[model samples]
Target: MAENGFQGALTYIYDPAILLRLTSFQAEYKNGVTPLNPGETLKLRPLCLEDYDKGYLQLLSQLTSVGDVTREQFEDRFNKMKACDDTYYVTVIEDTTSKQVIGSATLVKEQKFIHRSTARARVEDVVVNDSYRGKQLGKVLVDVLVSLGRELGCYKVSLECKDHNVKFYTIFGFEAGKGQNYMQIRFFD
Candidate 1:
């Protein structure tokens, strides 16, 4: 596969231009969205194979146990996701100055037959590095995924978070279902 090309897809899933146009930050800044700091360089884009060295897995470890995944394993998973067409959108925010992934999020689109065969999206693995917590990067990540879900024609998007983070998600229009529960069956402990 080419560096910037997908096997048979029309567009690259990790294209930065997608974020530039779909994020709320762009809506706020009609002209263009600038970095968080005038002197610092920050970029919001989709995950790429080279990200393996950019602390991509290290950043994910901050959210959950990433286990010792090798570079080959990372690329294998990435290739599988890309093969699924547009089902997965793993977005990332990089501190270009430091060449490290600072924050990340994923939108997984699920095809459904109930809602007139329309698809729905699940927002998952949203996290920001400890050192970069104060900035609005989290908000930006959520906004980007939500907007991408809509653009993909998903009927609705949902996510699960701890009780403490409920208030934060609410700001992005996520509401807790009255009697809904998030049950999980872990295969490994």
Candidate 2:
């Protein structure tokens, strides 16, 4: 497992097999949907520690295989986020019926410059359950989170995704950066 000991902490391991199986260890996460879709009653919300377990740990451990955010680094980052603002958001989409978490996303306050008043937001960790990939659930989850950032007075909202995943972010009106590893390509690739 390769990793950059950045300014903060990052913990990770290398194991593709476990990561691919994350969606299989689902736990029916519930959300409120008005006039729920017949047979599709799941909704999206922020994920909590309770939603995590051995499976999440197992897959997350592998995320650092190629040297991305290490576990300890993520924890430090999460703490910084929480300390910066209570509004720092981490959300997840869950199927109310099955109580399984389908997707997860996050928003963090970022300081654009020393002169800025309010910090901007950086969206990250946007992942949808593999089983529910084609439903556009990730889009919905990010849409709401983006709106939330706007409401919070974020002058700028940014997120980094893999080059292969550029298409996914483009749907939400995020401009693509043209350069070497633009958009944190090296951060988590």
Candidate 3:
């Protein structure tokens, strides 16, 4: 597989068979878009440059106070993000019928030296389009990300959500505030 393992180094040889399987898997994925509603062909995929201008960021802003970014700003950031193998995987839910990005969630793999060089994954920035709420798209999005985190060999997967959304996320196996407090230090306003 030749992926970046603990200590941030490739510890195995690149397997062509694995690559072929991944290619075939992606081909099947691209062709099979999940239908969520009538006239809406939704599919889940990794973020691509082609999705930059398709209201992807707008959907994200609905989650938090992320200001708008110019196309150049997004391009620069996307380049750096994609360069790091599977460290940052932002999965988007796209309506292929309308070519609109309606939902997104990110799975971040954190390799650690503790716990016998184990790794964990965090899910964040989960949101769905305002018009698409109550369709269970958010649940579908988080489930996909959790599956991905498991495939990445993460020992645990976690996420922090607003108090109101705690119950919503709990159904996905996340313990709501289980003897742990979430604190943050912001470097920017």
Q: Where does candidate 1 clash, by residue pair?
A: none
TM-score, one value per model = 0.84, 0.59, 0.77
The TM-score measured for candidate 1 stands at 0.84
Alpha-carbon local distance difference test for all models: 0.78, 0.53, 0.67
Q: How well is each residue in 41-91 modelled by candidate 1, as lDDT tens digits?
A: 776778877889899999999998999999999888898898998788998
TM-score winner: 1
Clashes of each: 0, 17, 0
**lDDT leader:** 1
Rank the models by TM-score, top first. Answer: 1, 3, 2
For model 3, residues 26-119, the per-residue Cα lDDT tens digits are: 1111222322221246765567676776888888888887786888998788877777765887877778777788988888889889878989
Off by over 4 Å in 2: 1-39, 53-84, 112-115, 178-189
The deviation in Å at residue 104 for candidate 2 is 0.4
Badly placed stretches (over 4 Å) of model 1 are 1-15, 23-40
Over 1-189, each residue of candidate 2 has an lDDT whose tens digit, in order, gives 223211122212111122222221111223522211212566444444344431343333333342354567656655665565445677655566666666666776675565366768888777666677656566666666666666666787788777687876776667765663542236543
